[model samples]
Target: MEMIEMNTRERRRMTLMTRVAEGLLKLRMAAEMLVVSYRQAKRIWRRYREEGDVGLVRRGRGRSSNRTRPAAERKRAVALYVKQYGGFGPLLASEHLASDHGIKVDHETLRRWLLSAGLWASRRRREAHRAARERRPRRGDLVQIDGSEHDWFEGRGPRVVLMVMIDDATNKTLARFYEGEDTAAAYDIFDRYVCQEGLPVALYPDRDSIYVCTREACLEEELANVGPETQFARAMRELGVGLILAHSPQAKGRVERRHGLFQDRLVKEMRLLGIRTLVAANAYLDGTFLALVNARYTVKARDPTNGHQTRPTTATLALVLSWQEPRTVAKDWTLCWRNHRLQIDARHAALGLPGRRVVVAERRNGTLAILHNKRLLTFRNAPAPAAPRLRPAAPQAPHLTRRPPAADHPWRRSALIHRPVFCPPPTSYTAHSRGAENRAAATPSRAVPTT
Candidate 1:
């Protein structure tokens, strides 16, 4: 009875001694070696001393509580959860789990269970994920990409799409545009990226077709191992840049966040600048708005690789990347862009070959650049004429106001000659009075002789 009744304090000390002196020394030495964690270790030994070996057993081990649920019920609830709300978070899930399915569980508890079953979003994962993303090791490693479709002219003109590429490490917008949302338009963005920002190591973009092409296109190594030959892709291929596709918008959330900022500030900027045409807005975008936006939104780079593979050389870019179709200057020294013939500005005669084929570099924001044999032409904007209005046509006279012919006049109606107002012969031909007319004419001649 005394052995079983060993005091809590003494038993804890004995347990501590057992652990610390397993290889070292006597009980006193062991006790002394129990370190600063001695309070916890001592308490455990004390419990065992008071209640025998049974005290060492867990406090809540054997008997189930009144409020505890059946294992079978939790299993069933998890099944229902996965089927109905596969991707939803736990707090939203718990309400449905309880009210509809009659499974009562705290959200945290449910979260842990779901995690064990591989059904929960990992909070720790999200935290570590954000941290890693926030710490890009190099500036040129990743570029954030997205497309914005809006009426840039605020209903004063056509709606255009703007494809944007911003640096992930520095958050600087390298290029943007006004175009229709299509692969062609996306290539325009890619072209700008090549020229302005140089080749990026990787581009982070949403799963739009431009970023990912079709599945067939992706698996086209056998048929088209040649890589992209489209103007934009060709440039990237030469520079060895890569494209990374995001399955969800949230995956490339940096570009999405930048979009939100642009919506708020860009709209206000347009309003302040009185931008009503695509032309003017694009000018502002390329020039003044750019500097302003970069100043405000560009965060300092997390890594210091400077984000540029190379400052593109005009000579190299010209040789490597083919742009618009080659056109020759006419004898009159005129070049053509779809019928708008241009004169080689006198200042650019330094290019030597007036009749040689030269490449025209058409940019995304509707700007045309002419590169002669080697030198580039500085173009002056051509003045356009104002729209002409149509003149109102002369009024025509009404038909009722015109003069009538003689037959239509009531006064001359009887002059329409009829053959002796001929009366119809009744059912047979009637012999006329030729003899009576001869007798009457003879009587009239005799009367005239007497007169």
Candidate 2:
């Protein structure tokens, strides 16, 4: 007798059908045991009589699936993956193959081929448990802002920090590449965003020093009626924009995940384009990359209304978005700031401005403005050596001197001396009135004496 290899279920079914065919068991009993209909069992029973155990095997077993790709195609795809797209994930590789290489295949199909061909490795990522937060209802309702320091040029150029601003509602993205991540870069990028998208209702950022001040004094302010703030925070407050600082990176996961996506896609794209500088990268981003990113990732907002307000005027923005500090005007109407002595106008000092506190606004464009009582004061750069000097008038002719009053004058009658004592002015000031006036005009506010 010939022996055939079969699994337990097939052997059992075969035995029952054989018994039925041999008249040792009823068809209904055979069907019941084999879990098949009597009609199906009868069919099996007839096949068993002629073919014996051969018919017991599954019909499609050991046969190539009709859905399988051709052997030649599979081999070609694996070779292409290994040679060209070895570092790309299955989804990205599949996209390139379909669009660039004229090859049509499902991502999973390509993935399996790459895996079997040892061109790619599989990684299982554990899903993180997080409380889902619904997106804001309207565009610009909440703008998530973050800076990602990365090699965006992917070794084609220097590393740069990409400052990204994403609308929480629509996922619309605005980004720029900078040399580094700092307060100035943040200000510049945000200023550009405001111009492009208007003022967002609120900003969501992590607790970086640029976004939040962590000093003890700042914390004290938080406990007081005043909240702790940084330059960026202060600017937002001045602009009437709300701030929501994330305690952890996961709190603002949208921007964080975007950073990761940008690092992968943007780097590869810049590499392909041979972009090597921040200016070129930013130009490409604003013109072309931004629209592509938005069209691909953005979704409709829950509400149709836009939350952004009209952008502030340039002058208003210059005042509010600048770095401001309260500085006291020196007695001479000079403001010492950033190692430069700025001399306020003598007219301002004549208005009793000495020792008064003024706000020094350092604009993003490297210009400075001195504001007192919300009004801008005129100032000039006063270098130490070139500062205004007080020089007295030259001595005048003796004829210019007036004669002393007579001893019998009423001013001397009850005086301590026979004649009213005339105290000579300092030698620095001569008897020449015109020369004295000119010297006084040139003197610094401190050097000018009051009568």
Candidate 3:
């Protein structure tokens, strides 16, 4: 009986209705899966036949529905919101309308209106989550750090970026810095996190070039593992911080989701509450915002044993992460770097080793520190002994002060002479004569005159 009823609609696509008609299907299962009426399915089939894929498209293809505000006005409002209020959603826009535009609407009602008007995510497709993130057991065990560029304030200011570090186990934001996205920002953020929250056992972060580096093409083997070590990663490693690479954003969904709340609620609230400056934002975050947010969501156990240990001092870490190259000291206790000879006062009896092999750690930015017996002996940015490039020598011949001979002289090359190979035909007059003789023959002979 149910199968006969389903025969009413002609389904072109592989909907459950068509599935049942094509083969075997239980009535209950078909009813559950096939939500469309039989007639609707037939319409879909008819549309497919008539217009192919075009007819099968969902209704109101290009044009928006009536509920949407006028294009110019909606765009104006959206622009205003973005500029003035940091791009709040329709619901948040209601406050703006009342305060500035003099048009007031309920937040929920505005959301529906925006949806009906086709301005909201009702039309946006959902992205699939890829990886599973297993948060560490302890609060201080692991922290996921990332940067987000957002209009923290409405349009009152320029776009600002936040470097956020959130603890894995407790979902607590340990530290936040408002700065542009870059390696320096990450380093500064790391430095602050260390001072404030102490060093976490591990860090889960996205792969950025600064945290990694690439080597030359020919020397692939030499630089095979030349990963992110512009500076920040090196410092982190020096501090004995664990680095975990996340293949996809979904792998760090905890931070990803936090970013969403930050973009939506926290950003909007900042605008409404008039938090403009980074210092102000930092103050607000410290007061209670982060604590409340963490308490609400970070419902996980803190790692029993605090994962952090003492921060390896700068001198020690320098040996570990610095760019190292082997070198030997001279008899006079001097080292060579380019043309500059770096002389350290090892001659004093206080120190040991008169002659020994040592390592040179050259900083990418500046300064060269020497290491002996795993201890940094002296530091100096020695002058380069020779330029990396050698200038080409002028021809070995001697130079004469006087000018050279003219072009006509033997020493000088022959004077360049060129002739026109093809001349254009005469257009003004018909050319019958090759020379004066032909012209004389054509006209009355000048014989009398010649006589």
lDDT by residue for model 2 (252-273), tens: 9899988987887777667657
Better of 1 and 3 by TM-score: 3
Tens-digit per-residue lDDT, 254-303, candidate 3: 88878887778777677667888888887877786777677777675645
Clashes of each: 4, 0, 20
What C-alpha lDDT, on a 0 to 100 scale, does residue 336 get in candidate 3? 73
Provide the overall lDDT of each model, using Cα atoms, as 2-decimal numbers. Answer: 0.66, 0.84, 0.65
User: On TM-score, who's better, 2 or 3?
Assistant: 2
Best by the TM-score measure: 2
Candidate 1 TM-score, C-alpha based = 0.40
Estimated TM-score for each candidate: 0.40, 0.72, 0.50
Candidate 3 TM-score versus the reference: 0.50
lDDT of 3 at 295: 77
Evaluated at residue 400, the lDDT of candidate 1 is 81
Error of 3 at 257 (Å): 2.1
- For residue 194, model 3's alpha carbon misses the true position, in angstroms, by 2.8
User: Compared with the true structure, what per-residue lDDT tens digits does model 1 show for residues 187-237?
Assistant: 656667667667678777776655454434334445648633445444556
